[model samples]
Target: MTPEAFFFEFPDGRKAQVALGDRFLVAVAPYRQRTHPCQVHYFSSCTGELREETFSVRVLEEGKEVLKAQVRTGKDGFFELWLPRNRRYTLEVRQGDWVAQGALTTFAQSPTCLTELRLSRR
Candidate 1:
C-alpha cells in the first residue's frame, strides 16, 4: 500500500515537495485572487506538547459551511487547509472528548502561514 500524500501545486505547473512529517505553507495566487493556505497545528494544550491525532473538522464562512472532513494529523502533528482570501472563518475540531473551535481570518495584512488550534478536554 502507498502512503497518502499531500502537497501544494503551483499555477505555473509545479508541485511542491512536501514529504510526510513536514510543515510548510505554499500558496499560488493569480489575478489578485488568492487561496489562503492555512497551516493548521492541532494539539493538546495540557502539557505543552504536540499530539498526533485525527479529528473531525468543520469550517464555516459567515455561518455557511465551507468544508468538513476527517483530517488526520501528520507525523509532525499538523494539517493544512486552503480557503478563499479576505474572509472570516470558524473552525471546529473534535476528537473523542477533546474539542476546539476558533475564529480565523484571511485579510490583506493577515499572515497566511499558520493557525494553531489547540484542544482541551470537554
Candidate 2:
C-alpha cells in the first residue's frame, strides 16, 4: 500500500509537493520577502567521516509528527530541504542502530541555513 502524501502551501500561494516515502524537508516556513532553502549534511560521530547512507528523517511541528521520509546522503554526505523561516522544528535522523536528533529554527534574516548532524551508534 502506498502511504499518504502531505502538501503545504506558502503564503505566496506556492505549494510544496511532498510524497509520503520520499526524502524531503518536513517543515514549511512562512512566506517571506526573500526565502532560502535549508541544507543538511550528515556525518559519522565516531570517526568524523562523511557517510552516504539511507536514513530516516522526520519533521515535527508543534510537537506533532508532520512529515516522514527516507533519504540517502550523497557521496559528500549532503541533502537539501526547504523550511519556513522563524518556525521551530524537530528533526530526527536514524540509520540502523545509530540515531541523531535536533531542533532548529530557521532565521528570518538569512536567505539560507546550513545544518550538520553526526550520528553515533547506540
Give the best candidate by TM-score. 1
Model 1 steric clash pairs: none
Q: What TM-score does candidate 1 get on C-alpha atoms?
A: 0.55
| lDDT (10s digit) by residue, model 2, range 1-122 | 01124456679999885553422232212211333344322222111133366778787988898768887655544544555445677777777787767776554332232344546677
Q: Measured by TM-score, how close is model 2 to the native structure?
A: 0.53
Flag regions of model 1 displaced more than 4 Å: 1-51, 113-115
Candidates' lDDT values, in order? 0.52, 0.50
How many angstroms is residue 116 displaced in model 2 relative to the true structure, after the best TM-score fit? 4.2
The true-versus-predicted C-alpha distance at residue 84 of model 1, in Å, is 1.1
Q: Which ten residues in a row have the lowest lDDT in candidate 1?
A: 24-33
